[model samples]
Each structure stands twice: as structure tokens, then as C-alpha cells.
Target chain A: MKKSDVIRAVFHSLLQEAPNKVWQPQHEKGLGFAPTNIALCKYWGKRDIELNLPMTSSLSIALPDKGALTSVSLHDQSYDRIILNDQEVVRDSAFAVRTSQFLDLFRPQKTGYLQIDIKMNIPVAAGLASSACGFASLVSALNDLFDWKLKKQSLSILARLGSGSAARSFWNGFVEWYAGVRPDGMDSFGEPLAFEWPELCVGILTMSEVEKPISSREAMQRTVNSSLLYGSWPKKVAQDLAILKQAMQVTNFPLLGGTAESNALTMHATMLSSWPPVCYFMPETIAAMHKIWKSRKEGLELYFTQDAGPNLKLLFLEQDKEQVQQLFPSVDIVKVFE
Target chain B: MKKSDVIRAVFHSLLQEAPNKVWQPQHEKGLGFAPTNIALCKYWGKRDIELNLPMTSSLSIALPDKGALTSVSLHDQSYDRIILNDQEVVRDSAFAVRTSQFLDLFRPQKTGYLQIDIKMNIPVAAGLASSACGFASLVSALNDLFDWKLKKQSLSILARLGSGSAARSFWNGFVEWYAGVRPDGMDSFGEPLAFEWPELCVGILTMSEVEKPISSREAMQRTVNSSLLYGSWPKKVAQDLAILKQAMQVTNFPLLGGTAESNALTMHATMLSSWPPVCYFMPETIAAMHKIWKSRKEGLELYFTQDAGPNLKLLFLEQDKEQVQQLFPSVDIVKVFE
Candidate 1:
């Protein structure tokens, strides 16, 4: 038997092991899309390296219609072909390695090679959670192509093996990723929020399109290892998560916005305290933040949060979209609700 | 008597209260200069606001000769005339107010008005600690003009009332300021280091000459009152102080430099966690830090620290002065040790 046969046999046994959910290949080809979700209460450090489990529970709003799309199909070639945004990714690249590892999860007892072509509408590695959407779209496409009757939770678990935030991208509207108690990470997954406000939305100020100098993975690990201020952060995050969940339940825009912004600042503080320090905010990022704060002082409903990049994402209601647009006229507005 | 006369009478009474020390003015004019000191372990927050006692003890090295010079002389004018850098400071300006308050410490019974001429060679409010040197020089000049016969420790105490860092500029070589337990702040003052490494020095990179956007006082207060990460920092600082003191005793350059850099980062982390975020490091600051780290990897001995502004001060031995100068040739170099 060839190497592909070996992978096929391994994947077949794994699928058989899960007797409750078995998937047969329905179509040889399919295309799917997954939009990125911007975290309100961020998930920074990880708890399980192998499963990509977060150290703290996080909340985010999904931005649909614009994100990452992946096209996958059975191939005649000896190995999988991984193409990212119209360009074939180098086999040795981390992205390619991760993609191949994720593909291994779906191998059958006997099968041919496969090809995946990805198209990303959002900037990559600039803290927009591009990897999140990329893997989610890839997994969704794979599920459709293989006729995987796997539930949404199972898809999220599979996607997380590719990227931690990818688990959240499987859900729509406001979603929460529980930092579950199970060491095996069986309980860790994203769930759609029960309550949603129709007017909730986000305006993104893309300060820089260039890849960040320090990747989020490296930054998170460094912060977890060296930052003295990071020791008590999980407990603080637990407290903030409770406050944010309550605000979300009541549809309190101001409370939600304030809590999200505070959590983002707390994340940046840990990054700043790390050895050698990880500073991501460019001068333009701060300018955008100041603009949001100034407009809020003038009675505008606006608040800002940033991931591991220089971009400033302003959270506001649909009724004040025009006002937020006036503040950030150049950036695109992403509607999270309605 | 007018208010000025009443101030003079009260000051005289206070001077008389110190029975062990009193010197009648032999000459009615004096000129003094005091160089600013860069804190290795910074003192950010305060405990006793009225007495200007620091929340944590700090260590610094005094930069001599190149600093602020003040020429003070008794005059017959109704109020004090304050000339800063050859220009008369406006009466309502903060500079003028602080100067007048500082002079109130030396007022004598029935003494004539004093005209003060201050020439600041350093950049004010740019994190060079210009205020420290300015107040130190002013106090020194006043001590000479009034012949108060106050000790150096007493001068530091009076200078602290103007700017907390000013207290450290009173001594040359390595000095440490004790954050005394006394509420009256009688024991809080800068003391010269008993053991000094004469070869240790610093080279500065003055990235910006403009005044900082936020004053250090306001930044410290904001961080203390609002930053969630600041609560346990005092304890961490105490631990760092012990480590730094041990390093200093052994003249361990790397330990001293690394500790200083970490302390500075911790300080910035707390500032960044503040409600509005007191960010002082410009992009250039991070660039300079990277350069230092890269150079150190290339076997060059270099470490860095910053105050409340964008400027970066590099710490290295006197033997590496030529190499450091090559790195940052555009900025001026101030020697703190022989």
C-alpha cells in the first residue's frame, strides 16, 4: 500500500470509532465560506497546545458575507495541493503544514489525493483572525464534499485543531467559546448566542495591511511565560466575562462596549509587560481610538477594541452607523446583526 | 505685612525651628547647577501626596555638569521675578507658580524680593527629567542666597516638594531614594551610593524634543487609580529592588541593565492598562529597543530604559562608549560616572 493508503486506513478507523456520526463522500467537489469573528472579550493564551484550547472563555460577533472561502475537490495527484488566495502555498510553510495536518483528520480507508484553494477577502496575519476564517471555511467545505453528517460542534472541534479562533467562526451572530473544564478538550467549542440586538455592528479601521512584526501565537506564549502582570489575569477575565455576558443578555450596548474595550486594554497590558515587549498599536490606531472616545463624549454611541494588530474596530448600533462612518470614513463597516 | 512678607516671616520661623542648622547670608546672590538623573528603577506612583513621598523606592544615576543652571539674587521688587532661559516666565504659568512655591521654603523675615534667572540646557517635559534638575538647581541657589545652612538631605526634601524626581538629582553618582514609612516624609530623600562602578554610563537617543502629551504626574495618578494590573506591582517592585541592589553590589552589568529594562516595561504596562491608556513609547522607541537587542546579540553590551517620553536611554559601560556612540551618533551623550 502507498502512503495515501496508510492515511486512508487510519482515517477510516477513526471515523468507525465514532459510530454515532459517519460521513460518506456525497460530492467530489464543493465550495464554502466562513466569516471572521471579532472577539469582544478576547481569547489570548492557550491552555492545551495539542487541542488549541483557550485559557479563558471569550465572546465575539460574527461578520458574515465577507471573509474567507475555500474550494476543495478530489485530485488525481499523489498528494494534497494547498493553494492560498490563488497562490500555491509552499509545502514547507507553516500554513501548508497545518492544512495537511487538518486534512489528515478526514482521510478514509481508501481514497485519492485532494486539492484545496483558498480565497481571503480580509487581511492575513494582521490580527484580523484571518486564520480563523480560513480554517473554518476549509473545514466547512470538507464537510460538504465528504457529506459529513458531523454536527456543528464536531466541525468546530475539527476546525480548532487548525486555529484556536476558528472554532468561533463556525457559529453566526454573537458566539461564546467556553474554556471548558475537560482536559481532553471534548467540551471546548463555540455556541451561537441565544439573544441578539438587531442594531449591533462593527466598523473596522485597517491601520496597516502588512503582516504584524510578531505573530499572535508568539506574543501569547511570550506573555504567558514572562509577563508578571499576566499571573492573575485569568481570574480577572472570568469576572469580566460574567459582566459582559450579563450585558449581552440585556442588550446593553454601552455596558457591552465598555467591557469589551476594557478587556482589550487588559490584553494589551499583558503583551506590553512581556519580556522584550510586544507593541502592536501604530500611531494611526491610537488616533482612531481617540476619535471614538471624543465622539462618544459628544453623545455618540461608540467604543473600540483591537486584537493583536494595529487596526481599531469600533462597536456601535446600526442607528448610529452614519455617525461612526463620519468618524472612520475610509474603513469598511461590517454589520454583525440584521 | 504683605503676603510675600508674611511668607518670609513664616519661612524664617521654620528655619529657626531647626536649631542645629542656621547660616546668615554672607552674600545676597548665588548661582547653582544640577544635572538630571535617570532612574534605573523608576518611582511612578506616590503615597504621601503632601510630602511627595514615593510609593516605591527607586535607584538612579545622576548626570552632572550638563543640566539646568539657576542664578538667584535678592531684589527690592514687590514680588519675585522669574526669568527662565532668558525669558520672563508668565506669572500665571505653571512654571512660575511652581518656582514661587519652591522659593517660599527660603523666605526670610523682612527680606527683600528675589529675582531668579534660570537657564535650562535640557529639554523640559520630554522625559529627560528637566524639572528634576531645574528644581534641584533652584533649591541649591536658594540655599546659598539665604544661607539656610541646610544639609544636602534637607535640599532633597525641599526639591521633592517641587518634583519627586528632583530629589534624586541632588546627589552625584549612583543614588537610591528611600520611600520612607514616616507620614511626615522626614526620612524620605535621595542618598548617594556607597559603592559605585565608575565605568558604568549611559547614551541617550532623544527621539523627540516636543513636550509629552500627558504629564507624568497625571499619568501616575491615572494608572494608580484605574489600572487593574497596578495593584500587585508595588510588591513586584520590592522584589526587583532587592535583585537590583544585589546586582549593583556585585557590579553585574547585565543583571543591572536587564532589571532596569524590565522595571521600565512593567511601568509602561501599568500605564497602558490605565482607563484612557497613558502610552508614551513612539514607534521610534520600539525601533531603538530592537536595535539595542540586536546589537547585544552581536556581542555588544547594551540595555535601555525610558521615562515619561519617547527618548530612549541606553546603558552600557564606558569601554563600549565608542560602539554606543556609533549606534546613536545624532543624540547627545551624558556621562553619569567617571
Candidate 2:
């Protein structure tokens, strides 16, 4: 695959055929990569100044089809190029400042024009780690350039500094961010809560025209400070985490799903009690719940969870996925971007 | 005095002047009494079915001015003289049916009536125990005909059958109905969370209104069934009740006022989660909460609570009363009518 090897092999053919050759050496190159993350049992409070830990266990996040990727080959010598979401990242001076800050946290030594074109399919701010997708793209490219053979956790440590939830991107399947009792009080550092078993799968029903009306950062802090109901929620989170890990071990819907639903409801209930209050459910969102609850009440086992936005993530037993899907045929499935 | 003493006095009066002695008869002389009960801490929500026990503590309530009274004296009566709120109670058949139901709950073991006269001044369910007042009044006159020495508690037991909260009307301040953990469950009778503490005073903010959109009976039942947050609430009721009582004992404004705000908020929160979703707050009700929150956030130190209606029940430390009232000089003030 060496350029010299190709040139030598072609040289003989070129000399024999008497073909003309032009040098015109003028192109720059860099790298690009992106990763995905899934929420474990812990969900962060949006408003906590520190991007504090979750109130309960929420499972199932849809990741990008392939992965975040971009080609950094220069189109010209002097003019460097960058691409994002499959479009050329324009040269904005402010983006320059932000990119530097982003790089410092994501990839310190590997810096330049980062002549790259990016293509990402991750949904932005839809209660998914879009930031991680972007940072993973940038970080993975730098790791390639500097040959920094670091493990995923080490990379995630860099990601965490850029965006707190970004640490979860390093692992696949059932993740947990241990809220360590650190003196510096950073608390959260992500780790996988459970290993993957192919039987465990997830499907989401997104009900949002946009991300959430309020950011998770603002919402969580308000609840922690203003809500009288806040004290009781963290306990529920612990219980949910325990129940979920056990459920994943046993590999059953009854225990696993019931725990997830309880945790999701508790988290939404916390939102309802915050100072100004925010309703995460639309009529359709609740309609979805009614459909699930009715089906279950009629003795069908279907389960769902909701994030800060209107998305309803269904957790069905791998055995009953088709049946559950048929039960909710009216619901529009969200095309998983990331 | 004694029946004979009453008879002698009547005869003497007749001799002294050919007085207009309208001789009203007994058993044969149809009569009834109606009395009002006051709620101190206030009763909300039903616990047991057959016997009504509330989940929260409440206080004893008697007629504030005196026993709530209404007299229905039989005289082959002139149609049906109904006087209330200084207006003739209209001769409506529906009204008659309702009146009869009130009488039927406690008519001396098959007492019948042909004609009657009625009068009362108590305000009806404008968040006032007018029914208690009316029922208490009807029964007091009947006490004359039957010569029954019914204690107030016994009468309250009967009144409670009419409207459970009216049980508070039969007694004075500092009354409590112990929700005994009996096999059959003792009556969740009207009980006082606080009695006649000389320093404990209440100032009401009365508004011009007829009644709430939903009755307590319907609202409470719907709320208990519909609130997903319901289960979590009962867990804290015991603690809330204990804390509020302690606050009352010490006249601790922060403790008492804050707890009251929380309890009232939660009661309404349950209403919002009702099956069809009931908003007990009038537009004015919401505006009041806005004002209080805005003012307090601005360091004005003002707050309010609403019953199941539009009128605002502003809560402030006794020490802050003057300033609080000054902030809304237009709001009317009334006694708790305990």
C-alpha cells in the first residue's frame, strides 16, 4: 500500500507505454473518528453546575449506524479543510477558539488545521450524547496522528473534560458513571454496568420536534435546589441500579422492565416538582404510555422509558420484540441516527 | 329546665297576658336541628370506605358565633317558610328533596313531618361549613321536642353522616378523631391537630365566590386513584403531620408556614394528576401563586395557599403580618370561624 511501491510498479508500465506524468504535489491530510454512548442506571441532572449524577437507571440508547467518521485529506495545499456531519466545517474564527478548547480537553498534542471532512449521523441534543459523537470524531483522529495508543477509559477521561456525559461513549451496552466520593467532588466517571448479551436489545419512540425545551443541565440543578421532592429521588436511583443489574444478570423482562419504568416515572415526577415545572410528556407521549399500560394490564408485557425529551424507549424481552412492536404499530419509530 | 317547669312557665305567661301562645306540639310536633362544625388543621382525603378516616389530622369546629341553628317548627305551616342569608329560601321541590335528605339522616327513629318553618344565617359551602351549621340548627330545635340529651360528639356522629367534615362542627377547638387501627377501623371522626392555643390565630382572605369547580368528595377520590405520585405521598404524611404539629406547638413560623405551603401544594399536585386532570386553581389562583413566588424570590417574604377554589389564603409569620397585608391591601380579611 506504499506510494513508492505503487509508483515503481507503474513506472515500468509508464516507460513501456510512454505515458506522461505530472508532479503537482499539493495536498494536506489529517484524521477523523466518532464514538457512541448509552445511558446506564444513572441519569444526570441537567442543571447541576457540576453536571451532577443521575436520579435513576435509564437503559437503551441508539447509537450511530457505523461510527462518526471524516476524511482529513486536503483539497489544496495552503487552504486546510475540515468536514462535520459529512459537510465541510467552515473556517470561523470563533470556532477556532472553541476548537482549541475542545482539542485541549480531547487531544492536546495533536493540533493543526486538522484538514478533515466530517460526517456524523448522531441526533443533536436529543438527550443523547451528540457531544461525544463530535469529540470522539476529533479525539480518534488525533490518536491516529500522534500514535497515542491509549485505552478507551483514558480517552474517555479526556472526553469527560469536554462534556461530562461524554465519558459514557467509550463503552457499549448498559453503562454506569460511578459517582465516586472524590475530594475534588467530580464524582462521575463512566464504566459499563453490564456486559453485552445479544439477547438484550432496545427500541426507541421519539416524540420530540427538538431536544428538550429545557436542558438537562438546567433542569437537574433546579430540582436539586428547589424541589422538596429531591431528597427522595437519589434513593430511588440506587434501588433502580441494583434491580437493573440483577435483572440483566437474570435476563428477564418482568424484573428488568418494571424497575426501568419505576425509575423513569420517578425521574419525570422530579421534573414536575421543580420550581417552574416542566412536563416531559406530550399528549402523544402519554398516549404511548396508555397504549403500553393497557396492553400490559390486558396481560401483555411491554415496557418503556422516557428521557428529558419526548422520546419513549421501549424495553421488550428479546423473545417478545415482534409482539410488542405489533402492539404499538401506530407509533412512529424514530430512525436511529446514533 | 325540666319539662314540668317549662309547662308551668307557659301557663303563667298565658295568665299574665293572653299571650300569642302558638301551641306547637310534639312527636306530633315536627321539628329538627342543624349545627355547624369547624375544621382546624382541616380534613382532606378519605382512608377507609364504610367508616371515613382521613389520611391527615384536623381540628374540631363548632359554630364560630354560636351553634349553627335552623328551626323547622310545625304549625300546619304556612307553605314552607325558608329564611337563609336574610333571603327567603325558595320553595323549590329539589330544595325540598335536599332538605329532606338532611333531615332523614337523623330524624328520631321514624319521625314524620307535615309542615315546617326554617331560618338560618350561615354561609353555605363557600369553604364554610354551612351544611354543618344548617344540620346542627335543625337538630337543636328537635332536641326540645324529643327531650334527647345528645352529647355533641353523638350529634357530630350524626352530622358526619351528612358531611364528614361537619363532625368538626359539634365540638370546640382542639378536637381530634383518632383514626384507630381497629379491625373494623374506628370512625375517622373529626379530630383536632391543634386546640385553643391563645396565640394561634388565623386571618382569612375572603373573595366573592359561590363554590369550587369540584367538590372535595369527587376530587379527593379521583386524586387518590389517579395520582402515580400517590403511593409515595402516604409514606411522608406521618412525618409531615408530626412536623406541622410540632411547628404549631412552638409557633415556629418557618416550620409551620413552609410545611403548610408544601402540604397545600402536594394536595393540589395530586389533583393535577387526576384521571381527567382537575385544576382547582382559578386564573386568580395561579396569579396569586405567581405573585407570592415572585415577591418571595425578590425578597418580599410573602406567600399564599388556596383552598379548593380561587380565594387566596396568604401564609406569613405573625411577625410579618403587617407587611404582608400591606403588600395586598385590597384582599379582604375574615376569621377562621373556629
Candidate 3:
């Protein structure tokens, strides 16, 4: 089925009405913001590619202020205009093309064109999940522009039509994205957990701010298609998800950190096993990892998780923030709970 | 059954006589040498750790002259004396302890004590399979010392009592070690393949010579016990073994190199999925891998395989020796088929 049919089915299920009927403009312009998230239990494989349905559930923590801010307004042109970081994106670029395609899902009948401006606090395409928060904030802006008054869960499903991880960017704390069984993904949405640890912190170690050679979407597809170890990934995610939740519930930092680190390594392990081998680690990435391991061995409570790109996200408690920062002077620390 | 009992049973079955009955000293001194081997299809998990029986069959190519040589002689001392590279090893060291334990299975009543001197061309404990060649040479020396005319298969089985990979080090060229289904491991031994590729070359890229923090024995045990991805390792080995043999049969260098590289990476992937994560890659190792991959993309036929340490062995052909040497200046090249 087409992505638009799935979107209409989702809107029909959630609002009991057509999207055009509820897409009435309430204002000339709308603004929205969303926090980026890092998955403690990673989302590595897909069950439905077109609908962005994951093969297993995942858990993530949102960075409080490191995300995307999007502003949207009705435009007179036939095609949508897109701007990123105050730079106009060319019409035929991959980014602009993808943004326009996602906008196609929510175009109002009376107003077909939109001007979208996005400002991301983190590096784009550098494993920072910039697309996630960008898509999520864009969905939020669309919701506000049409005065839909939808809940976070419904907005999450809409954002997921653009990117899978975008489903979990709607919340500012711990969030869990359910990998629903339905093919149309009517039930797959992010849910915010009530448990909160005010002392949790995430440190970003930016080895490279340049774009990754291989996108996470392509990497995930390659891993699932070729990696023999990919068969065990769902089981790994399930176990880590449980441990992550239990650790968060009791404020057990070590258990949480260790599991998150292992989960990320396992995801990369699958990628490494793929044919023509997808290795995202640079020389500096390996050096940083060895440094972290050595410091952790020497009685430092430091743990790290890596995404599809070469950068790392250090997971430590607020109590060790000073020590961690001292050890990694260039780290950009984010107060995850704050 | 005890290891000693298993050893005795194997001797009885092979010789149709007890070990001591055939342990007559034909000469006062005996000398033997063996070549070290690099696996194209790696041996990772073990089905029977006590017997050193692998979970699946593996294929390897031996590096001529880069191996171990040992001399053994009857001694008057009450205890065995072991010397490595002209230096006497302390009796309590791990190497001495393991050697003595394996010796306990082959002690003769007429010669209660012996002195052994070993010389290895390759660096010890540097993922170069020094232990494999060492044990194989020791077993061969014992065979000559006792005047026991055992076949290569029997010697392979005896060497495996010390290290699993030793079973494949008895031959000079390509050897396949069968993972026999017997509990006593009677059928598990190396069989030399007749296919000879005179142009095949192996280049040693030594990133580290120090002993690994975790031995391959302990690493294999931990991965088999804890790594969820290890469940698929046997299947990977089976497929790679078939492909390696086919590649050899047709003299397909690219197929052989690609399959071998993928096999090695899959083994490391399982280790990464284990708890506490057994990572063998140093920063330099990662840098070398990226260099090889980039060169391959730019029309080089170079590939590499890593063992349980940070060192890598580059797989290429004699035709590209100068080019490969120019790309990797410090690489030590060996003509495998010579």
C-alpha cells in the first residue's frame, strides 16, 4: 500500500474523520520544536520499509535543548519552499525532495504549498538524529497550522511517516517506541514514560561533524539483508529494553550504562558482519573508545554508545560530570534530565 | 572422562596399543619443525572445550618457514626443563604449566624427564598462531623421540590437545580440520588439500607484539557462553568453508579474499556482542583496515583477516607484491605456496 493510504488510514482511526476536513488553517504561521533522542536500545531493523515500522521496540532518552525548531506558513508557489539553518535548500536536492514528500502527507486542500524553515541545534546527518527532530517538529508545526489539536501519540505516528526514529522525538524525557504487529502501523507510536532521573546526563563526543558516508537508513537495510548476526538483533533489543527500563526505574546507573553501551556495540557488530562490511569507526573513533575503556577500568564510571556515524554519546550520571568532562575536555555535555 | 583418559584412548585407537608400550626411545635427541597457519574460514566457538573440538569445520593456509622449531632430549633431572629461544622458562609460568600438563599424557616410564628447546620465527601471542605451531612441533618432536611412526592425522589430533588450531598446523599448504561428531574427538584432524596456488601470498601487518589481555581460549569461552550472536556462528563457518574450498578449487583470488575477510569479521562480531565486549581492534588496526578498504575501492586487490589480537594478515597475490608493498611499506610478505 502507498504511504498516503497508510496515513489516511491512521488519521481515520485516530480522529474518526478525513485529514482534509480537519486540516483547517487557524493561523497564517505556526512554530514548533522537538527534542532529539538517543536510543538506549537501538532501532536497527525494519519490519515495514515504506511505513517506517521497526522490527523491535526501542527505548531512548531525549536531549532537553538539542533538537530542531521549525516554522511553517502557507505559500503562494506551486511547489513547497524549504530553508535549513537560514540557507535555502535547492529544489532538486535529496533533503528538499524528502522534505517535500513528507509534506505531501499533510497538504491542506485549500492551501497546497508551504514554506518550511528548520533550525537544528546539532549537526545534520552525523548520527545526531537531526532528521528525527526535524521531521517531528515539522509534524508538530503542521498540527498547529491546521489546529488539529492531536495528542503526542498521533503526532508521533505522523512524524514516523518521514523517519522511523522521529516517532520517539516527541517527548523530552525517557520514551519507548512500540514496534506494533499491524502491517499498516496503526499502533506503532512513542509513549513517554513517567519515571525520571533528574541526575542523568549525556555527553556528545563529536569525532566528525561532516555527513556520514552511509546513511543509517541504508545501513540498517544492508545489515538486515546481509548480516548473518542480524537474526539475533531483536532478541538483543528485547533484553536491553527490559534492563534499561528496570535500571531507570531504580536509578541504577551502571546497569543502565553497561546495557546501553553493549546494545550499541551489538548494533555495530551486525553492521560489521554485512557483506562488503559497513565499518563506521574511524581511527579517532577507536582511539576515543580505548580511552573511555581505560578510564572506566581505572575506576571511572564512564560508558559510551555509538550511532551509525563516527561520533559517540557518553552515558554518565551528573555526579561524574566533572570527571568525565575533565577526561574528555572537548565533550559537549547535555543534561538529559534537565 | 579425564583428559588423560581421553588421550590414552585416542592413542590406543590409533596405534592399537597403549601409549607407553610404543614410547620406546629410538634416539637420545629428536628435532621437529612446523609452519604456522592462518584460517580463511575461522574457528570461533567450540562444541567440546575439553577435547578442543570445534563447533564447525575450518579452512586455513599455512605460512611456510614462519613457524616453530623444537628440539627434545632425555634429561637426568627429576622435572622437565623448558627453554624458549635460548631462555629457560620458569616452571610456574602459564606456558610451562600448559606444556607440562600436555606432556603428562605422553610421559614414558623409561624417560621420566626431558628438556625441550623451542624457537619461533613469528612473535608469540600476537595473533600469529604461534601456539598452534609450537604445539604441533612439540607433538612432532615427541613422535620422532619415541620412534612412533604415526601418520599426520594422528599427530594433528595429538597437537590439538594443547591448542585447537594446532590440528590444522601439521600441513604446509591449505588444510581443512574436520569437526568430528565423536565425544572422544577421534575423527577430528587436519587433512591437507591438494590444490596449489603458486601465486598466493600473505603479508603480515603486525600492529602489536605484546600478549593479548585475554587469551583466545578465554575469549572463545566467553563468546560461546555469553554472546547471543554466537548462535549463528556455526552456520557462518559452514557457508564460508564451502566458499573457501570452491574459491581454492577454481583459483579465484577475489572470492577467497572476500570470503576470508568476511569470515574473520563475523568472528570478531560475535566477540563484540559478548559481555564486557572483547574488542581486538586498536586505533592503528582500524586505520589499516580503512586504508586497505580505500585502496581496494581505487583498484587494489588487497584484503585482510584478523585473529584474536590487533594484528592483521593481508591476503593478496604475488603479482601485486610490489604494489601492495608500496601501499603498505612495512608489510612483511611471504609466498605461501613456495
Q: What is the TM-score of chain A alone in each candidate?
A: 0.90, 0.72, 0.96
Provide the clashing-pair count of each candidate structure: 1, 52, 0
- Two-chain complex of model 1, DockQ on C-alpha atoms against the true structure: 0.36
Candidates 1 and 3: which is better by lDDT? 3
Model 2 C-alpha lDDT per residue in residues A135-242, reported as the tens digit of each score? 666555554554455456555544554555666666555566665554222344566554455655456676665866676656777767765555666665777677
* Worst 10-residue lDDT window, candidate 3 chain B: B16-25
TM per candidate comes to 0.86, 0.52, 0.97
Tens-place lDDT per residue, model 3, B1-338, is 78678877787777664455465568988888999999999988889887899999999999998999999887889777999998999999999989887887767643567799999999998899999999999989988887788899999998998899999999989999999998899999999999999999999999989999889999999999988899989888888998888998898999999999999999999999898889999989999999999899998899999999999999998989999999889999999987
Q: Which lDDT tens digits does candidate 1 get at residues A1-338?
A: 55344434434443564543343446868677898999998998998676678898888889886689998888878677888878888888877877777676556434545789899988888989998999899888877887765677877877876789998998778888888887656678899888777788888889899999888988999999888888767866887788888998787989888888888988988887777777786767766766776687799988888999989888888999887777777868887766
Error of 3 at A95 (Å): 1.4
Better of 2 and 3 by lDDT: 3
Residue B327, candidate 3: C-alpha displacement in angstroms: 1.5
The list of candidate 2 runs beyond 4 A from truth reads A1-40, A46-48, A51-122, A132-138, A184-187, A330-338, B1-338
- Clashes in model 3: which pairs? none
For model 1, how does the per-residue alpha-carbon lDDT over B142-207 read when each residue is reduced to its tens digit?
778766777788778778877899988888888888898876566788999887778887787898
Model 1 chain B lDDT-worst window of ten: B3-12
Scored by Cα lDDT, where does model 3 land? 0.90
Score residue B334 of candidate 3 by CA lDDT.
Answer: 94
lDDT of 2 by residue, B220-333 (tens): 787677655555555445555677678667767556555656555655655554444544555445545656666776775454554565465665545556666776676543
